[model samples]
Target chain A: MDRIQQIYNDEKLLKKLQEDQNLTIEDVLENEMVINMGPQHPATHGVLRLVLRLDGETVVGIVPELGYLHRGYEKMAENMSHIEFIPHTDRLDYTGTMCNNVGYVLAVEKLAGIEAPKRAQYIRMIVSELSRIAAHMVAIGTFAMDVGAVTMVMWTFREREKVNSIFDRIAGARFTTSYTRIGGVASDIDDQAFAEIKQFLAELEPALVEMDKLLLSNRIFIQRLEGIGILPKEDAIALGVTGPNLRASGVEYDVRRAKPYLFYNEIDFKIPTFSQGDCLARYFQRGDEVRESIKILYQCLDKIPQGEVIANNPKKVLSHKTEIYSKMEELIHDFMIINFGINPPIGDTYLSVENPKGELGFYIVSNGSGQPWKLKIHSPSFCNLQAVSQLCKGAMVSDVVAIIGSLDPVMGEADK
Target chain B: MNTKELIVEKIKEKFGESVEEVSDFRDDLCITIKKDQIVNLGKYLKEDPDLQFIMCKDVTAIDWATRKKRFTTVYHIYSFKLNYALRLKSNIDDNPPTIETVSFVWQSANWYERETWDMYGIKFINHPDLRRMYMPEGFEYHPLRKDFPVLGIPGSLPLPFKAE
Candidate 1:
């Protein structure tokens, strides 16, 4: 011991003394057995690999191995323009592209001190809620499937498609709708786009009711879930759990209410919470949240102020093929904005919106150049992944899947 | 108290020269402290009833290449009630930048500090569970450093595949 102490230092020796004297790093070993929960594991929800140290049924420890799908997205952002970066954000949370787009654009706006037009904010609110519904659909759908309810996934997506169709009408694409611009939306919402969204909402309520009937009261589903994967309120705060997980733990902290941004302040919606922080509580909390999201979407549509989607800045105009063909000046503006995206002032902003998962914030640092010095995506799934290790302890290996599924982690964002 | 000067005044009144909460540590409302004083500052921030900055939102580093102080460790603290943020930065060396872990203040930082350590090589001396967060198995060289390459020779500075 004296010889060992002599080599390191007094501080090292004291630390060694204070630690569980009999224990070593080697003693905290991954020995018993290996259970590789896959890059293709259905419970994982994406290309997520969790290597668990198992003693037969119980997981002794878990080693979360990511980057099977590292797009090198952070490094890629260094080269892309601010506008060009929107589509990439869509891919981050493949479940909810609109929130990703709004969060990112709002961040760029904060640095530039540009405000989205009232109409634009209203439109953004509509699309973001639609995306939230879509995200919750995927979360609840896959979660139900993970715990063995086959039909709900199909029911949720069937309605989700109607929402996607509305998005397709507005932004010319369903999934990666790079809809929100720095100052406003890419363009104004037409009568047709508004009609389609209204139609979708009308149809959406019944689908949600059907989903509740299908999952909420199902005996086996409730049995499998209920008290499983419980995260208490105080522990949830200590672990920095946010979004639905925080709400599930009964904290009632929503970023939209906590720190208002864009049209969130104007819009009225309830923040749903559950006293029980179980997997079932999280599942039901999201179900109720989808109802609240529908309410918000209805409010936005009812009160969407009459105005242009993009602000009056001529420079802000996007080059649509139709516009380019019709007007000579439009051609030049389109190419310039397309080739070189909006250049915000050299500053930084951490603009977060209540994304589908939770607090989806973008921390963008601009160095007086068009390119961002650093683009730190404070993704909700990435933050929530920290809770898995704690949640999985002393539980059966099968329970790990339920716990992970309840969290509803998207590996794309987690790995990003 | 204005959000800008609340932390500065509190730290100045308490620790005096032990810390400097300046508006422009890197041209923001930055609170600069000596490496040794981090634990005390963290504890004070936690127990002090007025500033319930109980949450350590993130722990990261900024590389000022070849400056007198090479790297700065920035700790972001968030209080839901105050609805404001404070950036506490500390200057640490390039060689395995080590600071005492704030696991005592916030348990969330356990994984966060490890992630920072894995990405930027900033060692949290008292981190109870200091293991890799993102990189692959047996990886060496912090990937997030200004100079560290995205690609490193596999198995170069490899620690064993630890499951903690």
Candidate 2:
């Protein structure tokens, strides 16, 4: 007790405390408590830890701690071959692996001066849009669930599962489908797979309507979300927020429209924009985006060319399995590709796609090697996560969950 | 002149000697400039009427292990108004490589700079929060450095799961 009193009374100790915390003695005595929200909280949606400084249920400051799921993806890319790293990208944005895979392959293809055929481009577009719908379903479903609407998850997931079944038919895997290859896709979509996609598209409009009826019209949901977590247009651009979040802030900067890639220029779609820039606006943008994706998918189905899926360059792209198995020369080519990997010219390329979240980019620096000299992922979630501190200022604690859900961050990509 | 050429010419006109090298790769204009002039370049790019590169898309660094200037920090800036993309590169030579912070120009550079520092050990001078981003604080080495082993440093605990 005497020691404690002596330390408290000491001038040096008091001065040190004041310097470190920038707090006056009076401020220290006042009841300002610091609390940790989660590295495990369900509201965070993933392994995100928010250190919130609170003064009676109002957030004074927030420090977001990240990297709970860092798997050294960039470092791993440096070590592995270009083809080997495709699966790793799937793990980055696990929910929207198709976009991640396409982004990576597109960058690699650019580096190697190769382009996927017209049919392959359309197929990539279709799968990417399908993945976008699946991802948005999870985003909206989980968002609704976070705001205390439990049935939204069940409704959205049912639709998501239907999409997953289509993915299962096209690619062997349902979740982390590494269907995209560097110069093309692994296999062409069959008639049955196409029919399944058409079926899914038929049912999607009604599902979206059901979702709108369930959550968008809910008065309590709107009351909680509307006019909350407003990110102004200039601030959104300054902070580098993209995709629907930036669109909600009235920035018409969808990568698909701004910089067309993979037959997006040929297809027609609308970039949804909302001037509100609040949680409700962000939610509305996602709903609108799912509709736009449906339009693109339909266009892709109608306009897709009937031709080769993979590029004809045998030196760059691997041959088909039938050719590799039957012909000795083709078998040797396969062996060489698998053993040494496809080496791109010594250069760097940056390619991004309009992911369900935002502009997911891959910046690859190739030194005329099988493996990349350096690979950097410009993850949308990581950039969007940075705005939380700016958005949460002076807001009630409950708004944090809505704001985070609206951002729709996946920790895997953010941490990487 | 095309947008790329105009950008190159404008940059050359603005800062003659400061612009080290300009290259065009796959239609993207890349300009390597003096490290000290990056912040000024960023401001010019953002505020320039013709070249309104308001959005700093990404900021990252590459470790050229064999080079005298061991690190090159790359910035990808996009102009929605002008409809062009620019790549800015600056080489750093400090033992712990240091470059000027562009967070003031674009608020998004804050986290990007932090991640660069965390991964490559490049310090951003005048950065408000120049701390480890993805990596934990007090971590000994930058994992993304060329010298770091791919299998990871020896004597560390083996990964729990084995490859099937």
Candidate 3:
């Protein structure tokens, strides 16, 4: 009893207890301070305001206020024709515009019962995978930047720029490339564009390896990320989290694997998953996904059969501009499709594509009209963002930025 | 029988008359059930060993202002084990359109329900945080309704120049 009392009353032990007690008192005095972390902030990626209740350095609760970039995309879809809405979808996930375009067109095609040619599907797959690489580059770049590794952003953007240039050659526009049409893509990939894409893929491999050494292998980065913001597998599934965030949580549920629309079934690629479900897992998931996308790009380039890009349906699809000018019948067809729009049968359908961020779904309800009766976009970022509060609970205040970065949400998609 | 028919058969067997209509369009199984039975059906689907639909993919409401049943609340549920998707829809009347909250069954339904309520003015009973998701607070009108003007609520927009 005397020995126990002596140990308790020891000078060093008393000093440590006093220090811990002081921290508790400081926390009690401060109570819960509500701090707003941006509708405008660098780490947020976009206008995402997180009202965080903090007990000292620890996050007690978080209320994520979104819709700052809400452009009324669903409402706008109701008013616009099937073809007219393709461009608007580009803004849904601007970074992954090709995938967004593919997703929207696939939904419209499903509604109209039109099938894009095999070559078109292959071309679409190639472009979509390229877009995935570009999007992931940005995601990883920005994530590393948020964690104070600014040089990674410059390296990633260099590769992303190469992709954008290739996209410009094929699609006319770089970032907001409304490349996809209702029945097919806007244009076919030329030989020059294909060569450029091959070159970009070749260069991206070494850059990715360099990034792994710089960010992934670095001790400081690992220490900051490892086991931080761990989202349990059940919570991730329950909250509708998808893409790398969901994959990081150890769920191998990719839309490509589960419901293979397009030539995803034909393509050989692996869905990378990590059981850690932490910031590090999410980071590594994107890194692995980029590698898989590179594999898909290679397969697409190799296996792409030479054929017509668009479906030949005069009644439903528009003709080429040159053909429209040369022939009166083609002119009328183009005019009719543009002015009146393609009227799909009265029905409702939901179609989703595996976007870089996650499953980007478009639910279209047609009333046998040119325009959709109702259009609902199931944005992955928005669904994934729902799990943020759950992820942030009990995490340190500094870890909030890391968590947000790892989730890789684009506000345009979320708000849309 | 295929997965779609199997799902329909199981659902029909369990609920009997509660299952209103079942349709298979393009291999996509859509089941329309009575509105009151949604929560129970959701629980059963999630818990039942045969049909373990763990994920609620999406929840949305479509406003058919002209129809007797003005709103159709759609729930897309997916089973990881089975690798099948089922779309369950419930029709709600225009007069104070309300439905049971499935948020209790799937945590993802919480935000989806809030968004539905925000856009279509469909009240989700027992939702923990049922508030405007996209639109700001104190915004009264449900914009997605067919009755609402395509541009927006008439005269609600702050025009730079006044109409003559």
Candidate 4:
């Protein structure tokens, strides 16, 4: 039977009834007391609330409340065409938006049934890895600050500035570089960008190595994380956890390895896993992943392929320039492409990509129309969030911050 | 067992007249069963060893605004054993929409079902906790429905104030 116990219209009335109806009887039976952690807390990388039922600091139950940052993304996508949705993807994971942009566009490309050119795929891999590194830096650095290490945040920001400058050189935006277009990319890699990437890679290496030295083996950092918030591998998978959190639990099922998307099949790297599903395992997993990302960047630099960046589908789409200028014939075609979006011949498609968090999937159904008939994003943050309730069942109240930091959920994608 | 063949073969083998599998499932599979048999199908999918479609990935209402009786609750599920996926669609009425819950099968459906109710107003007959997830409690209206104007609340039929 579908248990429809709570109703929105009657929540207060129900709670009020529960308060007075069985208060003498229920309270005599040792009922659990609810405590609200936050809709705004320092440890939750974004705005997240956890309703905990505690028996004197030992968590009896957990209810994760979300949607503080719901920007109406799915509804917003319905109003705009496919191409117009590029900017919206940037808001999913504001920390590492490049990966989010590629994740959405990849789904669009799958529905349209076309592949991005070799050069564009390689460039996407480069930019996405750079974004991955930047995201990990913020996650770990800020997580360190949450536990009382203020020094790591400054170091990470300094390193992140160097990385951001490279993105600024390419797309002229540091924070939200919507560089990924559907077919290929928004633009090409110019001589200036090529030099900046080479230079940044050199400067970024020692910073990561330095971070490893500073944080990983430190007694205080390890004490806060090592045995805190442990989740069993079986429990994590059963809870629908994905991305690094699952890998840190020793799953070893990276989507990059399981289902290689975006030139990932050609690239070589190790998928790191640790048997300990504690906060420290998650912390070091990101560290190992950052090292792996650096390895990917180095490989792409030496053997970058050469070809036209965007797809060669003349009827479907073209570069941004051809759409803006040129003859009226070109203009009409461009207008249809932008206005109508790619009219994917009536079919359903599900495409997922490995983000900094986990498997961020976009399940889309098209009706041979301009807009999507159905769109359901399987946000990894939303799925991984289930483990939190299970993981914190017996932990102290203060450890909730460490548990949240370990999961690293992005509310943009969660509430979207 | 191959998910496509098991779903088709098992349904016909067990309940001959009630099931049929659609072609082109290399990407994902879909099966059509009468709405009345939804509970049976839900139980079978949950219990069967080879086809343990245990996790209910998501549940959302698709509004074909221009079409008649325009409503459907799409169920996405994943089976770790089959290493496969399936989309089960159950039809709902345009007004007073409702569907059977698979919450008993997937405990994770508690909040997901509530969110679907809070968004599209598709009532899950026996959901354990059916309340607004993203939106505030005691608010009357499903925000995700197409007819619920981009900025209007359903009950009051007035502009949805941004701050409130």
User: Model 1: clashing residue pairs?
Assistant: none
User: Over the stretch A79-158, how does candidate 4's per-residue lDDT look in tens digits?
Assistant: 67787888888888888888988998899888887789989988899989989988888888888888777789999888
| Native interface contacts retained, candidate 2 | 0.88
User: Model 4, residue B47: what's the lDDT?
Assistant: 78
Judge candidate 4 at residue A5 and give its lDDT: 55
Q: How does each model score on TM-score?
A: 0.86, 0.94, 0.94, 0.87
**Over 4 Å off in model 3, which ranges?**
A1-30, B154-164
Candidate 2 lDDT, tens digit per residue, A301-328? Answer: 9999899999877778999989989989
Candidate 2 at A130: error in angstroms? 0.3
Look at candidate 4 and tell me the lDDT of residue A126: 90
lDDT of 4: 0.79
Cα lDDT of candidate 1 equals 0.79
- The 10-residue segment of model 3 chain B with minimum total lDDT is B150-159
DockQ metric for all predictions: 0.28, 0.77, 0.68, 0.35
Q: After best superposition, candidate 3 residue A321: deviation in angstroms? A: 1.5
TM-score of candidate 4 versus the correct structure, residues matched by position: 0.87
Residue pairs of candidate 4 with colliding backbone atoms: A2-B126, A2-B127, A3-B126, A3-B127, A3-B128, A4-B126, A4-B127, A6-B130
Instruction: Pull out the clashing pairs in model 3.
Output: none
Candidate 1 local Cα displacement, residue A223, angstroms: 1.0
lDDT of 3 by residue, A181-220 (tens): 8788788888999899889899989989999989866777
Instruction: Report lDDT (Cα) of residue B57, candidate 4.
Output: 66
Whole-model lDDT per candidate: 0.79, 0.91, 0.91, 0.79
